[model samples]
Target chain A: MIDPSGWDLPSLTDRWRSATPFGHVAIDDLVARAALDELRQGVSKEPHWPNRGEIFEMMASGPPQQPTPRAFLEALGGPAVRDALAAITGYRLQRVDGNSYVYLAGSYLLPHTDHRPGVDRRIAYVYYLSPEGAFTGGELDLYRCTTDGSGDIVATEIAATLAPRPNRLLLFDVGLTTLHQVREVTGGARISLAGWFY
Target chain B: MLALHRDVLSTDERAQLRATLDAAGWSAHDLADRLHLATANAGADDALFARLLDLANRTTRPLRLRAFQWLRLRRGDYQLLKHDARERPPAAHVELIVDLSAAATGEAELVYTDGGATLFYVPQLPGSVAVIERPPALLRYQRYLCLRVADAEVHRLRLTLA
Candidate 1:
């Protein structure tokens, strides 16, 4: 269990800044389980496939579906997360969202980026619902987005993979550099809640 | 043989993949061309090189496939592709408007241009709605009016052509 009070956000900010292409986040089991429970009780429905990287995300939106609540977002959007965001862009956050996703067995997501030029959001954050050691082979993979102004997209993917440890929050800037994706789930169901802060 | 080798495919499997490629309107030469683009210094006609090309091209649409594939590939990566000022027609514009509203913690109207329907998110009823816009079968896209209630904060969403 993470004592949110004990979490020293400045240190966490250091970790995030030093985090390579793989990225660093704050997650604890209690926190992860709480987030998961919120997702489970929340409705599930078809998600909008808006662009190149929204396959698993489709299940979180649309009719009779469970959308994430402010409570869950509040839990993940602690002072540390906010501070980390501030450190990255040197700007205060106007709002944070808890965009939830629940994936049954065999769900997979391809590699891509989170920040587009038109959107006014900045950071991308995630909280893993499935506990570590509960399942096998659901690893979060990060990629580097290499592009020029002319719409040429080239992604050089890093091989480092992160296990879905509950309560751990994966956070990063969805700017011109960060490109990322989740590998296919090889075993049981995987659940997570993610969002961006404006 | 319990498991197949990673790079070296059995003779039967190799032939099967080759046939599948042909069915997909691809030739060994066509596959080679794709590989050459992915690889540096296109050394055409190298035997060792051809085997590597065949192995890589066997996979379908690795970059963009169904939803799961997209999630897996973007595990640690987060990005936003682009935004535009281009004017969208009623049908296409509604989807964009809904996506933006649903993206935040607010309330708004989702207009479905094709169907001339205005959808709202009522937390009490709390359900999803699919609106058929652009009636003729010729138009491919359909609009789904989605109301996402997060944290007691409700958002009205729509999906239309961009």
Candidate 2:
């Protein structure tokens, strides 16, 4: 569960607006300490499958079937959290859907934008649940893109690298310029809950 | 299906081909969601083409060379499934990929997939050639070259027979 009193909505909104290379913000300790353990336990119990392709290789779980994790997902899509996120990013997010992900050693995701025409995805988010000091080299990398007159990406360069620190939440705009990737996990596993708000 | 032929070229022959390809000009293809690598068109090599044709004919019906190219993937390069060409001749075809790297890194590989399921894999082994049947729905892509393998470079010669 989230603790609204701990959040400074005005400051988060400012940060989101001023962020570079397309809008994004990272919030640490987003979840209430008392509920964190239950959430992690529920996620760990879910079944996962190895999803591999040319651009990515990682373990992904479907929508949580357990009551605790399912309830947490419902809370995320509920009006309170949705309004808070809307205030920060200025996007009218109606609902959210997410799945658990595990990036083990040698796993990676190459650069890509989460944009798709007519998909209606407005914002993307990742909630890091990995244990402290459990992994190395699995950073979320954002890229700065240069687009041509026709609005096609012509070039790109790294703009930011965000560590998957436990209990941190990363939110970014979903658009053509928001190119990003998950760097390869060289050591232990990197676990997280990631999804998009529509 | 996939078949691998080891030591298809002699050491000296492979080295000569590598040297020639190394000297040719290459253009970068940098589409983020699709691919990021260097590609070049090599000069016509009638002898090599004939040899590849003969090799492919052993397993498949008689075919003719349709196209060929050189690919170079350095560290941090990749080719995603979306980049595979969708336009192809209606008849069944085969693809031949000859590895020419100085040494095999084993990180980069060619994978063929259909409906999200992997059908075959081609490892990166120098002096080896992979022959793969190309059906209309089959898609192939080269895996990403990770940066952990310092100075890793993968050079391959790809030929299309239809």
Candidate 3:
């Protein structure tokens, strides 16, 4: 579990500025090992909607029945994480909302922006539960966007591929130009806590 | 396999269509030529591509095939492709769509969605073209393709949206 007491965002603005392709940053060891292990167990056991298709996403929604997952999710949305996120992304996040995701083999999310109106979500974020190399092919692929003068959009080359690692936090500004995708998982499974910061 | 539809083109029309594709840079009927121009043209000739595809994809008048494009799925890869625009500001202008499987493949499907809720799904067939009429804005849809390398044929698919 993350303790927010005496929390200070360390060089958060500097790090985001140095990140290339887009304004984003990732940090490892975001949670204690014991707490993370518990979260993985709790999340894996939660009832997730296992809807499979070409453009795929399986969600384990909250309020969670599993104690560990519920605690971890709450901690992630708590002031500590929110404050860290706000400093890093420069958005006054009102709250965070998301569910656990399990991307097993054949599961993938297609490329698109997170620009749903009235959502009030400003920063897209994810925290991986599965250990690195535990799963294959679930890269958080980010893209470069080009817009015609009239607002027509075209996603160009991929600017970065952030691998889903345990205890790592991946966050980005959410907008029409912020295109990203979770590539198809070819083996095992990818478990993560994901949501948007408002 | 999906129920193959009545061939919309006559013998002469088919010949003329082939000539048109040849004149318009689609000389070869093989997989590579078709797949390349379809994806790589970058919409520079979208109208031309759409027009030629419409001719090849013509099903029946007033309900003609809207679009025709192909996909090549290799081993251990997704055989099925999404039917609509993968990006937002959906390319909903074209509606009459058809998908054709030219090589070895697995099961395919036509699923209809209403506000993300699936209303219906129809199994698709290989070596055949799948057709979709212009769905209402209330209904969203996409095609499902499952291809396998063990099928002993290259999975070649032609997709059309009207």
Top candidate when judged by TM-score against the true structure: 2
Q: Estimate each model's TM-score.
A: 0.48, 0.84, 0.72
Tens digits of per-residue lDDT for model 3 on B59-138? 43332334443333333323222223332224343332232333324443445565456655544344233343433442
lDDT of 1 by residue, B26-114 (tens): 11110100010111121122352233333323421112111100000011221111101111232321111111111232322222222
For model 1, the superposed segments whose C-alpha errors exceed 4 Å read A1-4, A22-24, A29-58, A61-69, A75-89, A145-151, B1-162
Which ranges of candidate 2 are over 4 A from the true structure?
A149-151, B1-4, B23-29, B40-46, B57-66, B86-94, B102-107, B114-119, B132-137, B146-152
Sort candidate 3 into its docking category.
incorrect
> What value of lDDT does candidate 2 attain over all alpha carbons?
0.85
Task: Rank by DockQ, highest first.
Answer: 2, 3, 1
lDDT of 2 by residue, A2-108 (tens): 65556789999999999888889988997877677888888889998998776788999998897767877787788988898889998888999999999888789
Tell me which residue pairs clash in candidate 2. Answer: none
Candidate 2, B-chain TM: 0.92
Instruction: Using TM-score as the measure, name the better of candidate 1 and candidate 3.
Output: 3
Per-prediction DockQ: 0.03, 0.44, 0.17
